[model samples]
Target: MPNGEERPISYASRSLTKAEVNYAQIEKEALGIVFGVRKFHQYLYERRFTLMTDHKPLVKIFGPKTNLPAMAAVRIHRWSVELCAYQYDIQYKRSEDHGNADMLSRLPDGQEQETEEEKVCFSYINDMPVSAADIAKETKKDQTLSKVLQFTLNGWPSHTEDTRLKPYFQRKEEITVDAGVLQWGIRVIIPATFRKQLLNELHENHLGINKTKAIARSYVYWPNLDDDIEAMIKD
Candidate 1:
């Protein structure tokens, strides 16, 4: 009965990683398309179907005949590569007209599963100066960070009087929790108890202030992170 009646077969959803949460709006839209295609790969791999999205620009970027620009973002290139394996056509529907997908996205089913991105985020734990478990446990013990973690997961309040949480509150949007450890845009938020030890490790090789700060900037974050590095060097 191919009478042009729309039907739903399956649904899937997952949360974004700390880094992904910071992607540009267009990038996020592109990611959603990739996520859906991948989630239903078994059903859609060899079959032809219409991929509908409210993000109009995607029509051009993902259309069957459009050539991806050489200056497009790396992520766009990667996602396009993934779509190359499948046979489908991309179309744009106005947001108001795409109520079903929009509503489902707004009220996604409640189920938590580790995504590949999170797995990659956790892969480097063994190489870190502090283990993920240590960070998680210490985070729970540190009153400020523990509170920050709770706020990040549950949702932050409009205002807070605690001076300790002020800095975190100011940047609440950037904070995220992964397996209990808090992170700020991919940088691990080191707990107070472990900062001293981590500082020692950073300074162990006498990498100097600039080098030390550069290394710390890449892997970890905390209040006054730069100041702490400077103080450790002076002391």
Candidate 2:
């Protein structure tokens, strides 16, 4: 069977989440590659193989030797990091020529259930002072963050006249929503109502400005977050 003919060993598919459904086309394409690789990691791991994608840009972005741009979409960069664990060559195939995968894509089983990994990440949130629901509800109540949530789910505009929304717009590519909570990369985006409370908790130990900022940066984000922490410590 080494005569350049292809054979299918297995198949897998699932519907996208509401958050994933709104991802930019490139992000969705990158997700597909990551999903396929992860779904079949048992077979794919420790072996060399060729990854075929209908998306031409992925061939370059996911190429083994490619250097990802520093400003590339955060999700894409994260996926690229996951891909680095595998040994494979990515190649571009025209959609018309990619019949096997195309047919499977047209027949998704159902909405994806939370993976074990996600359950673990969400479980970590339960141990925090704030819950996901609290963040989500307050995000809706906060006008500026509410707008940022909408932009993250839908698409960000090229420009915004509101200065308050400008910082979020500039980092739009790094923003995402999960379980109703807005996030910048892995950090939760705190709403205005929660910021003061979180600031108090962060400062509780008197870890001082630098240590508090480091801890806060690990778990939360808001515009001028560092400045806010600095001012709180100074006052």
Instruction: Assess every candidate by TM-score.
Output: 0.57, 0.68
Give the distance in Å from residue 194's predicted Cα in candidate 1 to where it truly belongs: 0.5
Clashing pairs in 1: none
- Which residue ranges in model 2 land beyond 4 Å of their true spot? 1-13, 17-27, 36-78, 85-105, 110-112
Q: After superposing candidate 1 on the true structure, give the runs of residues whose Cα lies further than 4 Å from its correct spot.
A: 1-113
- Model 2 per-residue lDDT tens digits across residues 131-210: 89898898998989888877776666768999999988877665666666877667888899988899988888899999
Which stretch of 10 consecutive residues in model 1 shows the poorest summed lDDT? 102-111
Worst 10 residues of 2 by lDDT: 114-123
Across residues 190-232, which tens digit of lDDT does each residue of candidate 1 receive? 9999889989999898999999999998788888889999999
**Distance (Å) between predicted and true CA of 74, model 1?**
13
